[model samples]
Target: MKIGIIGATGNAGSAIYKVAQQRGLDVTAIVRNAAKAREVLGADANVIEKNAFALTAGDLTKFDYVVNAFATPTAYQHIDLAAKLVRELRENKTTKIIFIIGASSLLKPDGTKLLDSLLQDENAANWIATPIEQAKELTFLKLIDNVEWLAVSPQANFVPGPAAEYQLGVDHLLFNAAGHSIVSTGTMAEALVDQIENPTVPVRTRFTVGDK
Candidate 1:
């Protein structure tokens, strides 16, 4: 399958790029700068570096699937960018879009979200804003329907590490006895590839990575 990972040079994007290649899929990575894209991601994978804001309907049509794991520098602006992507898909009739949302959107057992928990302290508000930005983009996507969208939440404590054992859950969360939710980038990448081939259509729900 031919796939395009929008924001394919970032940490999460780079992880996906490597996994896709190992799986033998035809992949194209769209990044913001060509030179950096080649340097950071290497020159083996197909890559196109262009300002995301400058992407058009034609740009979106170049792939069979597009996973938007990119995040804007700010939250409010991120929503506008996400809207553009949704609009771009509609205009081009491109049907599949997988958005890399934040873990803040997921609900804790107490009914509060990860974002709400983090916002309780002054020292953490600024830190939490990053995830809140993801929430904003997801809120805007709620109004879109032209594409099949999948939103994924990394474990509550997303960190850099090798792929570990995990589970998958939809619309809620998966937590271990230690009350921590975590999954390696490698595990998340595996679940994503599953969705790419046998996409859960009309499944605009959010999924999480946990101990499988």
Candidate 2:
């Protein structure tokens, strides 16, 4: 499969990039810095450096799936980037899109939210995370009626780990018997690949990753 990963140099993205190659899937690392991504993600795949939001239909002819792990350092840029990508994806119909969304949009037990969980504290790690953009992206993506897309929302706590045997859920929280929220990056990547191969989140649908 020809997969294009945006922001393919970050932690989650880099992990996906590595696994894609290990699976022998043809992949492209889309980012601004070819040198840095080649250093972090290493070489052996196609490197497409440029913005996807502004990419014309002619430039969108290479890949079959686009996983957007890209995020701007600032809040405004984050929203803009996501919004533009959604618009472009709606316009450009050449590739299937699998967005690497944040878990901030996940709801908590008390009916609050994971995104606002750290809203009170300015120093919380999730605060600076990219959920805000994910929320906006979700809103924009929901409006498009005829697009093949998958928005995979991770568990509450996602860290580097091997793909533990787990269950997959749709549009809801996935919790363990102990009620701890978690999802391995490896398993999440696996699920993302599945959606890419067989889309279930296309056009106003969602999928979740966590233990059941």
Top candidate, metric TM-score: 1
Candidate 1 minimal-lDDT segment of 10 residues: 198-207
User: lDDT (CA) for every model shown?
Assistant: 0.76, 0.73
lDDT tens per residue, model 1, 112-131: 77788778867985576677
Candidate 2 residue spans exceeding 4 A from truth:
52-54, 91-94, 120-129
- Scored against the true structure, residue 200 in model 1 reaches a CA lDDT of 59
Residue-by-residue lDDT tens digits, candidate 2, 20-59: 8888899889888898888987765579888656665445
C-alpha TM-scores of all predictions: 0.91, 0.84
Pairs in clash, predicted candidate 1 = 166-210, 166-211, 166-212, 167-210, 167-211, 167-212
Model 1 — TM-score against the truth?
0.91
